[model samples]
Target: MTLAAPTPTVPLNGDFWHTPLYTRTVDDGPAVNDALHALVLDRTRTAPTSTVGVRNADKTSSDLLRWEHPAIDHLRGWITDAAWALNDHVGAGRTPSGQDAEMIAEAWAVVYRPDGIHQLHSHHDAAWSGVYYVSTGHMQEGTGLLQFVDPRPSAAAREPDRTPLYTIRPEPGLLVAFPAWLRHWVTPYQGDAERVVVAFNVGFSRS
Candidate 1:
């Protein structure tokens, strides 16, 4: 029998932001969520006392833990694959002539936000950043919407002809990827339930 031709792998940058909202309903998502909850809660108990600004509200985050847990390595792998796929789409001209792409993972948590919400900001040193929703209650309905602002100031200032901002509502198993420099924020949750999400940043290194 004649062998079939192999399907070629598509480049990542071709469709990087085509799907800004990437979601996966893995069977392991619930388990991962449970683990994240426990991790965040445990850390919160002994977390260093510090205050952080959440939009107009004041909130606190667990100390930034780089590779503190074993699970983080797994999460890093998942993020790596996803980031590679995204980079294939957005990485073409962004990288130098002969440098290999590099990606890094940084994880953090935000806790105790009765009416707290993060202000519009971008990851300065990262190439891409994402948030994975862990738990959101009914009262916190629509609490985890990630809003991305247009980068073009001139286009934004064009009055009625301005480009519309994009908003993405993430489910428990959902993951989103966007340019690290894109301004974004989370809306305040109205309900009493606390919203928890694991956020990460990925970037390329000069190889």
Candidate 2:
């Protein structure tokens, strides 16, 4: 028998796809950031040139998250909660039992002076990555932007408003996190005052 005519339908809206991005403006973040800025800048006094990745910026150790300080301690708790929240998001609100497994982490505090920049890179070793902006510095627009390259290679060019690269103009207390494998970079810091952030990654403990 011939099938009946198919029913006509239209989507609720023109937008068809979505990507998950996690963000939060922290409570009491200003005070926490002030303490961290001083702590990290002071740490750099002994080693102002050392850096990691392709970053043209000064940074405290990649192990900065491991160090003990009141601000770091507060962030440690926040990061744990944030990572778990990300787990819930990825799981569609049905998080698996093992998803809450202990996390092994690496984090650092970066201070970008004028002309400082970080080239595109991804954390090949971690399952999640994040950044918490402490200071954006005295700068005009288009400076020190955090840009994430589009992950879908097969997609066609998008509208100008939907450029291939996703970017964020950082502000104090803003925290952002995403999959560790997503490639991203920072635009140059044109501001004379220092631009600061605490960047990090986390993966489940293997052992």
Candidate 3:
């Protein structure tokens, strides 16, 4: 048989090491908002004397409702969805079973009044963390925006044109979830109406 020449091939270039974020909206948003608004402002629920940054200015309940609260239950389901979405996005084909079940360690409500801000911090001792906006209030530019800092130190140097930070303006009934280790903060609120949010932390457990 006659010999034949091999054709040349080219290599493909693409992005790598991208972070995953999961966002969702509740189906019964209006009902959930009503329930959360009332629960966050419930006078009987004790607001702890928190020493965390700017927490004194914002209203917060120390109560971690694992069950019994309808809003919390709804949020629990949504967060679980976020976890599974993460499993699909990051672990697809990498592992046989993907991710395991997640355990809700704590859940609480936060109300940000004018000038309220949560200092830059990361959730410790949890695998996943998320926040649900019960009421975003009248949000304007730079008013109580949720911002996440890039966890990769080399990202900024690698992509100088791209900003190393990401921001999300909270909307009613909106939920945002991410890895617990990512550092994030809320910019000081400038609106007259109070901004309400429910936050939770989740960890994985073996069956």
Candidate 4:
């Protein structure tokens, strides 16, 4: 018997990061936003400082709670599917051994402002990292563009002055994935509306 031809696959790279963002445009986005706002308000009421970290001018980061909320579970599932699709395309049947690609991490939300922005940094203990834009209110300026810096700037010795970096404009329902080791940051928002996004950090597990 003759073997069938293999199906063609798309190449995985930085360009594809935002090209096909995993999206879910539910009519209840506003409702979900309200719910999230309530949760954040409640959390902040008692322990005003429960929300830690810099670049949080009206922003907050919560611990990853995989089983705490239905919305979170839905978001997690979306990320899992996207990650698998990306690995299949890039790995060409090779399984990921790193903790980031294992899909065992928790989920968290970052809710905040027109001026809030995260500084350049990377997740050290996690295996994989991702961000899901919850809302991108109408604005043309700085709606928290997620920026990633190339890991190998020294390789571009010819242009030592130019460090390669990429930026992904925030879009409602958009999801982005990248290696946990990649250095990234969020540009300060200058728009009139606030930017809300959920971030996750995955880990490895035997089960």
* TM-score for all models, in order of appearance: 0.74, 0.82, 0.78, 0.69
Lowest lDDT sum, 10 consecutive residues, model 4, at 1-10
State the lDDT of candidate 3 residue by residue for 82-171, as single tens digits: 655654455431234543333444666777777788999998877768888988778777788889988888877879898877888888
What is the C-alpha lDDT profile of model 4 across 1-207, one tens digit per residue?
A: 011112342234444323322323444455555555456555445443434453654443445353366665555555565555555544522335533333455666666666777778887666567787776655465456788887774657877766477777777766777777788888777666665677776555444
lDDT of each: 0.58, 0.73, 0.67, 0.58
Kindly state the number of residue pairs that clash in model 1.
8
lDDT per residue, candidate 2, 47-73, as tens digits? 554677535678777777767789987
Query: lDDT winner among the candidates?
Result: 2
Off by over 4 Å in 2: 1-18, 47-49, 54-56, 92-99, 157-162
Candidate 3 clash pair list: none
Residue-wise lDDT of candidate 1 within 1-207, one digit each (tens)? 011111232223222234343444344667777777677767767655344546433222523435366655445555565566565554431445654444445667665356667877888777777776666544355664678776666664557575456776656655566667778888776656666667777665544
Off-target runs (Cα >4 Å) in candidate 4 are 1-53, 58-64, 90-102, 160-163
- Quote the lDDT for 41 in model 4: 51
Which 10 residues in a row give candidate 2 its minimum summed lDDT? 1-10
Candidate 2 residue pairs in backbone clash: none
- Give the better candidate number (3 or 4) by TM-score: 3
Better of 1 and 3 by TM-score: 3
- Candidate 2 vs. true structure, TM-score: 0.82
Model 1 misses residue 33 by how many Å? 0.8
